[model samples]
Target: MYHDCTQVLDSDATTYPDDPPVELAPHTTFEKDGYRVTELGFGTHSGTHIDAPSHTEPDGRTLDSFPIETFVFDAVLVDCRGKAAREPIDRTDLPKSTGGDLLVFHTGWDAHWGTDAYFDHPYLSAEAARWCADNGYHVAIDALNVDPTPTEGAGDVSGNAKDKPEGVPAHHALLGTDHLIVENLTNLDGLPEQFTLDAFPLSVSDADGSPVRAVAEFQP
Candidate 1:
């Protein structure tokens, strides 16, 4: 069966404070034009989205640079429930024998989707980021970021890894290695330990990121 792991986008969707406000004005209404069309507008990273390497790296690959096959993969869920704010998920905590190219973190932070609490939820340890890079895994998180949010408490710093005082290094870590990063995911709790993931980003030329309709397929 196929499960929609994507977060439903609407007016109340949570977003980074810096992102543009989402707008869905009617371009044409059935009453006036006998058709329905919307003028959609939002930031590249506005909703459940993917971050390409160019999101941080100066000469990194953009969304259109990678082959479409890179977005679809087998996946394993990493349970991080009850992990504390800014808590780093060490590489040691990851599954020893994961079954796929994607590793998704289920932190249960989607519970706090529209509040300040969501922004400060647990993040991936710097080591975990490097682990994904080293192992060639596509990573997705239910939290606002794979790393810490601005103003959140610092977690365990990786050895000599330059820690950003106001940001987590996961973005730079994954993007720097040409790894993919998906954020603001929801409905991950219903997923099994292993599944099929098809996360395709918009083919926006030269863009750094795009909202994705992430889905999970698995046998029931």
Candidate 2:
């Protein structure tokens, strides 16, 4: 059986500070004697989503441009649970078992969901991001943005400094490559330390990103 690793998107789901929060409007309701339907008004990158190359790279591929095979691949999990604020995930933090096409980081940070702590959690370093890109890993993440938090004197304006360093090293290192990234994952704690991860985004043409329904299956 497969256990879901994606976070459920709801009106109350936590969103990035600058991103618009999810909104649900009723187009029709079954209780109102109409078709059971609802219209969602939110960003494409909302909730447990995959960021395509186009999301950060100017000439990168969009949601529909990715091959089906990119969505299905062998995966491994890396647990980085007890790090303090602003700590970067370097090469040594990863486990030896992680040699798959996909790498999922189970930081146990998802427990901070809906609070300010989640948004300000630790993230990957530029070296780590570069390592993944150079080594051919497809995905990476914790529960928050990969960029560091902006310091008081820093000239950065992306509002990612809370989790990253002076510059957006992680983004440049990771998204600069062809690898896709999955962010804001939850329920990873229930999964085994290692498992087969299956994460695929919706095939929305021209979309820079899409929310994914990710899952993991492990054999005892």
Candidate 3:
């Protein structure tokens, strides 16, 4: 069976504050051109997307630099649900054995999509991220970011890792190790513990990141 874990990309889609919002305009109508053509505009990291090392690390590898096969990964779901807002998912929250190369953290935060609470969803601790990186596991999460996303309210601290304010240590820990990150993933609750993740980014030249049609495949 195949399950689509990607979020829909429309005008109402949640986007990073600093990124361009999604736009869809009628370029040609059926009445005039006998066919419809819509013009699309959105940032690379607009919706359910993958982030390359260059997204944070200077002089790091871009999405296009990776081989096509890199998009498909054996993934294991990590259930980190019931966490409070702005809480950190520490190393203790992870299982000792994943049996996969990708760790898909299910925070159940997708339930708050399109709301302010979504930004306050649980985030991965830098130690947890480093643990995954050290074990050569890529990371994916059902939240805005692996690190805490500071909103208008509450504290801005992500985790107990040092260098908290200078940069997103969780991002640095994973990306600095050349591990890719997938964000805004949904429908993880419907998936089994193990599945095949197929999320291919756009082939844009020197792309830092790109929206993906992330899918999960597994036996029913």
Candidate 4:
């Protein structure tokens, strides 16, 4: 069975501060043209998306740097639910051994999507992120960011000048190397611990990141 783990991108979709929101316009209508086509406009990191190394590292690899097969992963899902708002998921929360190349965290924060509380979802600690990177495990989370997102009036969306770790420590730790990070995943309630993840990003040249249709497959 296959499960869709991607979030829907629409006008009401939650987005990071300053990032562009989803925009749709009718390019052609049945009454105006023979065919109907809609114009789409949004940032690369709009919804369920992958963050390539270039997103944090200026000279790091982008989405176009890897082969298509790289997007497919043998995944392990980590249940980190019931966590407090803006809490950090430490190394202790992660499994030491996993027969997979990817680690997906189910934070249960996707239930708060499109709300201010979603920004306060649980995040991965810098130590945990580095652990994953060192262990050669790609990471994904069912939250807005792998790092803590700033509150509306707390600071900028990048989490500058806040109680949290300065800058994006989780991002730099993981993306600083060759690993990838996927964020804003949804519909992970009943997935098996082990599964196959197919999350292919758009093939954009020198792209920092791109939206992905992340999917999970496993035998019932």
What is the full ranking by lDDT, best candidate first? 4, 3, 1, 2
Taking the tens digit of each residue's C-alpha lDDT, what string does model 4 give over 1-220?
9999999988899998789989888999999898899999999898999999989898989889888999999999999996777778999999977678999999999999999878878898999999999999999999999997766544443354454545899999999988999999999999999999999998888888999999999999
Please state the error at residue 132 of candidate 2 in Å: 0.9
TM-score for candidate 3, please give it.
0.94
Candidate 4 accuracy as lDDT:
0.89
C-alpha displacement of 114 in model 3, angstroms? 0.8
In TM-score terms, candidate 2 sits at: 0.87
Off by over 4 Å in 2: 96-98, 149-167
Clashes by residue pair, model 3? none
The TM-score between candidate 1 and the true structure equals 0.90
Minimum summed lDDT over a 10-residue window in model 4 is located at: 154-163
TM-score of each: 0.90, 0.87, 0.94, 0.94
- Put down candidate 3 lDDT per residue, 82-195, tens digits, no spaces: 787788899999988758899999999999899877887788888999999999999999999998775555464443443133358899999999999999999887799999
**Model 3, poorest ten-residue lDDT window?**
157-166
Q: Candidate 1: lDDT over CA atoms?
A: 0.83
Total backbone collisions, model 4? 0
Stretches of candidate 1 above 4 Å error?
151-165
